[model samples]
Target: MVFTPPQNYNEIKSLLENLEAYINSPEFHEIDSLIKMPIIHYQFESIHPFYDGNGRTGRIINMLYLVQQKLLDIPVLYLSSYIIKNKNDYYRLLQEVRTKDAWEEWIIWMLKGVEITALETIKVVNKIKILMDDYKKEIRSEFSFYSHDLINILFKHPYTKIDFLQKELGVHRNTASSYLNALAKHGLLNKVKIGKSNYYINQKLFNTLTKR
Candidate 1:
């Protein structure tokens, strides 16, 4: 269904300005963050200020708002994945808000997304930590060039290159290449050559990130 947003440029402009003010308003500050965010998200989406990227921008605003409230140390709790999985419900609930004034259902849906996303993020973080520890022990036992910095560099960039290691570890090109090659040879990294450049893939880290 096609929803008609505000068509007048001046009206859209004013609504967007009001949204900015509302977010920083004392009335907004009085509401709990979990409650306030969904309301703000609805307001932004309804305003639909931009022709494109409204959904993406709204999600970003949700994260930023959480950070601004000091509820998160970083803006890592993303609801995009959850929304993607339940896109039909997301759109339906949003439409219901405009048509039937279904604020409760919309707020509940958003809150549930927040809860599920937060839990999933925690699980992913724990998995990464365990994988990093395993890599540390195995690489230290097998390789002479093992260091905490090496482990960090490998995990920090799932698709790592010799140039990355060279700059991060303050090593020469040959030295970085030797380290990456050794890891690839040991089956710790899968080395793929793209054109003239080689990228060492941390398969476990890549899987962790891309896993559904």
Candidate 2:
């Protein structure tokens, strides 16, 4: 389907000025940041300042605002999944606000997205923590020589390379390869070849992330 942006090209700068004035105003800060977040997001999206990447920039601003307002210790909770899940509703609500000045509905929808996404993110974090604990126990039992830091680095991403292990552990390439191979043997990682390079994939963590 074709996309309809919230603002006309000529209106971008003035809309952004309005956005800036609102954000910098005492009234904006008087409200609870969480209460203000949806309003800010809607305004930013409606402004549509950039020629491209407005959606992405708007999403980043959401996390940054949380951090700036000290609403979150970390800028981790994301609304992308929520927006993607309710793709049609997301666009429709924005359009409603533009066409019919349906501000209440749009605001409520955004607030709901934030609440739902926060809960889902918390669940994902807890699951990852549990998986990390299990990995520590299994690794310690299987390989007494394995470093906890090494295990952590693997969890940092779904796939890791020998070079990463080598750099982190400050060991030779062969040693890193051997460690990865041992993990693969214990079903901790799956070995995969891409072109001429070998990589160790953290299947459990990968599956957990990709599950939803």
Tens digit per residue, CA lDDT, model 2, 38-145 = 788888876667778978788888898888888888888788888888989988888787788988888889889888988888888899999999988888888966
User: What's model 2's overall lDDT?
Assistant: 0.84
lDDT values, one for every candidate: 0.94, 0.84
* lDDT of residue 179 for candidate 1: 99
Cand. 2 TM to true fold: 0.87
Clashes of each: 0, 0
Task: List where candidate 2 sits over 4 angstroms from the true fold.
Answer: 1-11, 25-27
**What's the true lDDT of residue 56 in model 1?**
97
The ten-residue window of minimal lDDT in model 1 covers 22-31
TM-score of each predicted structure versus truth: 0.94, 0.87
